[model samples]
Target: MTVRSEPVLVWDGAIRLVHWLMVLLVPLLWWTAEEGHMDWHRRLGLAMFGLVLFRLLWGLFGSWTARFAPMVRRIGALPSHLARLRQRDSTPSFGHSPLAVLSVFALLLALATQVTTGLFSVDVDGLESGPLAIMVSFETGRQFAEVHEFNFNLLAVLILLHVAAIAIYRFVLRQKLVKPMVTGRRPRADFAGADLPDNRARPAAMIATAIFSLACVWALGNFG
Candidate 1:
């Protein structure tokens, strides 16, 4: 007997919202920072910081696929995924694949490090300082500023890699990964197995995500 797979809502509403919002905010933050728009940079940074925190929390307590455990695949499984792609076979993944999972974790870690370091950084003219700059030593702040700048550059490279990976998955591997993210739907296949989402009613969950995200930004701007 042939086994059939059931569709499941792996990425819940909150997960999808955070995923796309960060996609929008990351470029905005990078551009503003690059242009030396410190004011806008600071504002966007706060928003990004809050997002990171919220994402971390959501990863811990959100829906099935949103949790790190399910998504965090072993590096050893990467070869199997690649092989499936090569053969044009359906790879059953309820969450991120091993390679993609590592990419997501690395990107988040890099961004978090950059933001926290930026909190203790200081500008060249001594006029603008990060929110926590006053708490750290002048030398320490200066070091963090340098590291922050370096890490931001690394983050840019990682973003490019991420885009390239998606392109490869879509065009080369013939997988519609982007469509699933944008439309909240994955293509069904005969061998897709048990990895499909069942609940597609994530619009309300997305709204809650937006509200919670805005609340975080407001609190950060007003208090932090």
Candidate 2:
């Protein structure tokens, strides 16, 4: 007879919400930009910025599975992790694998760069400008506009790579990477006796963090 292990919570609701929201909003942002809907594009950019900020704060103050410390520590063992991967040793990580943490950080930084540049960007005709474009010289704003366009392409590449990685893990490695992000839970057998955290920040905390992020972005756009 085969014994089944109980399911364990691996991702928090807030983390899953933010992840899926980004999945939707990213394409919306791209489509809006392509359609010349600058108003919707700018609004989407602000929402993405706020979401990134909320994720950063959540990484620090939310759930253990979502935190940065374990992810960073795992980075030092990346060599061995790769070795195990080559050997097909399917050791389950309670959170992101070491290499995944690097990708996550890179995506965050890239998104931040995109949003910051967009804030100072202006179109060639000067008809459409970011809220904070007025703070910079026309020449500087134009330069930033160029950078903003470039950064979107970079973000697209990163996202494609991310999706490819997920596919590789799902098929080659026989790992289900998307399920936990959607359901916030994974079979206990996947962890292989790993000590996982049970504490997750309340929904109220996520709401508060999101509000704080939007306020910060609003203040920056208005005052600076």
TM-score of each: 0.82, 0.93
Which numbered prediction scores highest in lDDT against the true structure? 2
What number of backbone clashes does candidate 2 have, counting pairs of residues 3 or more apart or in separate chains?
Answer: 0
After superposing candidate 2 on the true structure, give the runs of residues whose Cα lies further than 4 Å from its correct spot.
Answer: 217-224
Full-model lDDT for every candidate: 0.74, 0.86
Q: Roughly what TM-score does model 2 have, to 2 decimal places?
A: 0.93
lDDT digits (tens) for residues 1-96 of candidate 2: 999889888889888898998999989988998999999998888888888888889988788878887778889988998998898776778888
As for candidate 1, its clashing pairs are 5-193, 7-196, 7-197, 7-198, 8-196, 8-197, 8-198, 9-197, 9-198
Clashes per model (N, Cα, C within 3 A): 9, 0
lDDT of 1: 0.74
> How well is each residue in 1-224 modelled by candidate 1, as lDDT tens digits?
97555434545666676788788988898788778898988887887887787777666656656667667645668898778777876454656788888998999899899888878888776777677788888888889889999998899899999999888877776666776676554545522444354444445554566578678767656655
Give residue 27's lDDT in candidate 1 (0 to 100): 87
